[model samples]
Target: MPTDHPAPSPRPRGWLSRFDTLRVKLFLAIAGANVVLVMTAYLIYSWSFDKGLVEYLNKADENRLQPMIVRLAEGYRQNGNWAWITEDRQRWQDLSREVLGTGRMPRRPGELAPTPPAQTPSDAQPHNPSPQAPPAGAPPSGPPAPNVPPTFTIDPRLLLLDPQRNLLAGPEGRTEQAVLKAIVVNEQVVGYLGYVPRLQMVASLERVFLAQQTRTFAAIALGMLAAVLLNAALIARWLSRRLRVLGDGTAAVAQGDYSVRLPTRGHDELAQLAEAFNHMATSLQAAQQARQQWIADIAHELRTPLATLRAEIEALQDGIRQPDTANLDSLAQEVSRLTRLVEDLRLLSLSDLGALDYRFAPLDLGRFVGHHLNDAASLSGTPLHVRTELEQGVEVRADGDRLDQVLNNLLQNTLRYSASPATLQVEVRRHDTEAQLTWEDTAPGVPPAALPRLTERLYRVDESRASASGGSGLGLAIAHAIIEGHGGRMQASASPLGGLRWDIWLPLNPEPANA
Candidate 1:
């Protein structure tokens, strides 16, 4: 028998995966750059410090050996030869001790000797004690002594050489790297004082100071790096939060939540993106609402005609009405109305898809309007008083059949909707580079609020321009689309004649001379 077991839930993301987001990546990039920069600076500072310390110690050694050079020169002057120092090691030691003022023998290798203190005036006159002298080795009791130059203990590396550069005293076999100071007497070179150049820091205080400084610098670098990391993390988190909001908004829109809006807080690119997304969402919401309204309108329009036909046919089948000429004619009219609505919808779709076949050719606007006016007058079911103000030679590039269709639709609307014996005023003129046509009818003007949406598909005024006028409401919409496809525009407004006004603008064909 199988035991009942619960399903395993999803495993939580590992720490590494959790840090794989853009925020973490950005933080790491900033931290890595700071690390590289700090390490490079530390390495460069250490190298420079080491080089500068070696140079400083070498210079100090040269200064300390200066007094020794003078003493060696004075000895040479007195002796007039090197026999006194060369033959006697004890003489050389005494001369070096007296000149250096340390009163000590030369130190062996690896031995660290502290620098001797500066000499007081009393120390120079030890044989005769003065009344002003302080007790032996007691701290001075008076105003502080004047600042003295620093002295270094560098005797272990000291070497003496003759004019020929042969070592005479001190250490041996270090001549190659020794720095020699000339021992001169009366402007004539006699012998030389030399010492080996310092290769590394040897003083305990210097080594301790360098180590402390290194630790301090390392701590400062780490502090600065920590600050940079904190700043980077904050910035990354802020950016990531903003981006996540946008992502959520986009996802909502994808899921058909058109009402989703993002917060636009600043003038940055991210803020601009949020604003654009909000605008797009608003447009999508409006389009969605319009689409639903359009479907409802289409259904209502089709239902009215279908219901009329169905009711009449059912009456005849139930023997409640006979199939007479008037009854058949009523049914035919409903079918015709349905057919027209379908055709108008198809035309609008074609225009939307850019599939409308337009054969463009230059046609004289004046003559074209005059011909259509005559045709409309001859075919009018009710008497329409027509007036025309045609400007001759006003030409435009347009499709003749399409232009005729537009003109017929306009005339039909005027004849069907306008009161009988209504006066129709038509005007054609040239306005700059465009041919303008204005059609105005007398009385029954459209409402002010309904003027702008006159070209919207399936939209109708509920008062004088209602569906009872036997209009499919797609005529003006189709006309608007056709005009737009021809690179022109159509507009409606309150007419001066107290009816609806239609303004049509078509680009004028270039004159042959101007072309």
Candidate 2:
């Protein structure tokens, strides 16, 4: 018993592989590079732009708050009274609370009070609360030791400063390093003050930054996409122009005008391909001329012999050469020759029409080869050494009858053309979802010049030998058709034994019906 393992399946292609065309690949590559470059530029611009904007806003804010602090200090000094300072402080604090959002300032227990707003410090405002006095015998609160204002409200935006650098009563204990200008009056500082606008303008700054970033990124993305599309369009236009030229050239060649040439003076791959195409056209034109000449020569050769045979037969029928075996045999032979030529012409016509029938089924390749080997050995009369090296139980979906025709033609060609005592080697191998079969002979293969046209009907390597050897020159052509009809391919090349090698490739997975 043999193993019944199925053949491997073909690998499924990914989405990327589906766009394997050169045009699609090139366009996608261009677009991808453009997107990466645009995104990188946008990120760099936004980072630097936001930093500079923040610095400028901070500086302008400090200038605006400077004057307000100086005015409060002057009124307290001129009056020499803490009452005016208290009144001023209350007014400023209230204004600040309205400007910057109001929230309870952090305080010790009992520090917050329900006391009426301070008026004149001398109006029995009861000196300083014991809790307010830091035991340093700090001067009575109000104007800063005669010159500095007792208390003053600085801009909340100026909150970014170290406590040691604060020259005005900063809202609370909050401090930041952005505070650039600190205020000082007389020798002693009345209260800490400085302006770092980030404290007050951060919300506005964040909103602006966000909006800028969004706009910048969005613009870059869209701009990049537009640039890519434009570039692709230009590239496509140029490529399309070149391709159109090539298409026109191909059409001309198809119409039998083989004098087509493409412009190929660039360092691009397209130029190289164009040059190569022109070379191919030149070669084909030369080959066509040779083919036309060969056909004329063959027609002349065929006509002379046919005319002579017909005349002799007519004369013989009229009792010219007594209808003997020699004369009748000669007549019969000529008819046979004419019949073979007509059959060859018919095979070529069918191949051109692409008409071939195929009936497919799962076949045991080893058994198929063995059966054919028996027939070939029996018919050839010479004991053919059949060598079969195949993976056991390998099955293929193919047309068995068509395959039999293909094998018979190949074997017949081998027995007729190959040297005596020839051996037939059949090998069946599984490769992915395809099965490859190779048949080799022990005689010299056809010449290299004839290799390409071996499957062409009536195309014999030696026309002289074709007549003498009784070859119709259509066997290999028919074989090629049968293999192709079964969704397979057949090719002839040099064999391992220095003879002809006919290799056939068939799909193990049968194509679906109607596919």
Candidate 3:
């Protein structure tokens, strides 16, 4: 014999398996939105901050270069030409360093030391030609004191250009995209000082500052993202918990447990759903109770006649009672009562299922009521006093046969339940858009509480008396159903005539336009 073995369960695929639940889906949706927003803000802030910082640096550089332009202009005025410093490259380098207050440039290996300029008349007293005595409180000024070292250094890229655009001094190959300042002397353009604009921050302090700010921004972005994800997770968890409760409740109902109810705490859609679910459960519970009661009532109703028939047959078989005419008549009556009860139940079943046939036609409401009352009184041979208050020409759309059945059931109930020599009153009239009919009888009244339930199937006020009088208890129920099928409603109330009252309302038939 082969050995039996269990197969292994399939494994879940990767990390995505954890995201299959509603909680994960909700969390991901919220977290994804937060991430996109945070990232976009970070990128935008970085771009704007970088551009603004560059513009700020460029403006500061322009302001600092203003004094340098003015000093160059003064030097040009004193020399009256550019040859004094241009011919001696060493002199030009010294002037540049002294004017801008920058550190001295380092010399390359094997490079000759720069020679001092020769004694030329133009070079004797450059940049200062004002030969006046110093005023009191004014510091002695021969050459202007060098400005404190600038925050930034640009000595290597700074250059002097003559009026014709020829490079006079400073580094070569850096004139492209250079910022230029005009050297104006005596309202005439003399030369230009230019420096290449910085493409990125090169100063150690500036680089450190930018890097620190960038790190701060990134940290803030990350902190915000983390907080948003936490909040998203909390919200998703809360929602999923509520949904799980709903799912459990629904499953309980499916399993025929109609008592499950969910908490309706908030005014959200979920709360509304819970309320609706509770309502459905309550209705199903009532329907289930009603179904049980209906089965019990049917069994009880059938057993009475069945037990009587069985006892009578057993008596005749044992010869304890002869099958004489009187005995046979009693059995026949029991059978008739049983047949009537079964037929009534069948009719009620058909009506409940909306399977009752109806042929609607316009009938005079007052005339119809009068005709039924006369037939019932004459045929029943009851000594009850009958009265009719009929409003002529009150027409309603109804099925004639069903309308007759409703009237006969009401008359029969009156005859069976009311005391002999009691008054039976019938009234028909038009009230607004409806045709209203009221049928009331005198004495042996039903209890107020039982009045509302009179039209319920197999309901009887005096069960023993109703049974003795051969009442099937389905007459009113069937009558109510037929009236409803004919687009009418029947209501039972405490009769002013001291018995039960039945009120029927039907829509009035519309008059023909040509009429």
Candidate 4:
């Protein structure tokens, strides 16, 4: 019977994926900037308009009334004739008429308009009929009122002054007009004028100004939007190029190629990111190579014993050989080989995980060297020859067992690889706060290329020889880890014996060294 299961849910999108569209982000940013810019611009425009409008109206008022008053005063001062005087009155009447017209004409196209004065003749005649009349209506008005002056033909509907401010000597009538006052000179009220301009005219101009402002704001907004989109595209393109490189590198690494490198050309954050990525790639490549080499070394090490065991068992099954001591020993050797491999793997794991514990103690260099020298001589089945170039009683402090393991590994390694009856040398010296131990063997030296990789795990110069000599391929690795764990430095160099030279460094203070 089949079991029921719920349908699999789709993966949810992250915030960066859902809301990070480049174009949309750019648009929103541009929009926010424009809002602030336009608000500030609008306030400036409104203030300017208010200030300019008031100044404009003041100039208009001065031009209209001040020039007329000046002319009347001058004419009266020059000549007392009513004709000269009346002529000035006619001009003032014309000014009032023009102001009441549909629009204020700007000085008749080419004329440089004049200004008004503060004082004028008070004896000027009235623009309307006399109120007293001549004795019981007296022949229906004196001299026909002189045909009422052509300047007065303008419509009264647009008159600037209301009835209360009116100075005209005429019959009473009701009409609505702007508030105005006439200047008094020599006891005569003449020349009406408005201080605050007509609201209708001001409102009309304001509407047009507002429309211009809107157009200007829109144009600026459009320009900013275009600039934002262009910048976003350029940035996104650059980022995408780097991302593509990273993706390709990832794919190459996945396919077991660790030699790929990323470009580091720019000084931007992306370049730093690329640098970090390249470093990671390089490290991974090294790790992968080491792992592969480890597997191959293990296989090669185990294959011989396995093949021998298989051959011996097969021979016995076919009755070609008896179950004798020789066959049992062969099987036991195979088991021992497998056990050694497992132990090396375990030790490496502990070292890598920083779980290897040590018991530290004071150690004497002279005594330690003598003991190990004798031990290596016996194990290699060759005469131990020691050439010492050192000062005695150089004492250092560290874990004795771990340090001995490091020395033993190097000693055994030299003996196994070096020719038999080789001479061994041990030297001890002190420099500043640190002590050094050097060991060399009189055997054929390693090649220049192999020297640098000698400390690498499972790396060997002669793999076939390593198997015949029963080496587990982890001796140098263990030595490296032990010395490093003790806060010391271990390095290999060319020896005067024409073989490998190993050096171990330990601080006399026994404190951990800075990496």
What order do you get sorting by lDDT, best first? Answer: 3, 1, 2, 4
> What is the lDDT of every predicted structure here?
0.81, 0.66, 0.82, 0.65
lDDT of residue 47 for candidate 2: 65
Q: Residue 183 in candidate 1 has what lDDT?
A: 86
What is the RMSD of candidate 4?
10.3
Model 1 lDDT tens row, 57-86: 788777777878876776677557666666
Residue-wise C-alpha lDDT for candidate 3, range 148-230, written one tens digit per residue = 55456666668889887788887887776777888888888888899877677656566677899899999999999999999
- Whose TM-score is higher: candidate 3's or candidate 4's? 3
Q: How far is candidate 2 from the true structure (C-alpha RMSD, Å)?
A: 15.2
Per-residue error (Å), model 2, residue 258: 2.6
Which sections of candidate 1 miss by over 4 Å? 1-17, 37-206, 416-421, 431-433, 510-515
- Residue lDDT tens for model 4, 258-357: 8899888878887888898889889998888778877887787778778988898899999999999988888898888888777877878899999999
True-vs-predicted CA distance for residue 328, candidate 2, Å: 5.3
Estimated TM-score per prediction? 0.73, 0.48, 0.73, 0.61
The deviation in Å at residue 80 for candidate 2 is 9.0
By lDDT, the better pick of 2 and 3 is: 3
The C-alpha stretches of model 3 lying farther than 4 A from their native spots are 1-20, 44-207, 320-328, 511-515
Query: Model 2 over residues 1-515: C-alpha lDDT tens digits?
Result: 99998989765488856666556666777767877777787777766666766666566555655654565445444444334324334334433432333322323355432243344656554666566531111112332222222122334444322225532444565455545543344654444445544533346446566687779677877877798778976786678678878888989999998888888868789898899989999999988986896587558557855996978878888877778898878888788777866765665567668765566677877678878787777777865677888765667777888788778888878777777777778898888878889889887677877788898755788777865666766778888877777778988788878888888888775554334
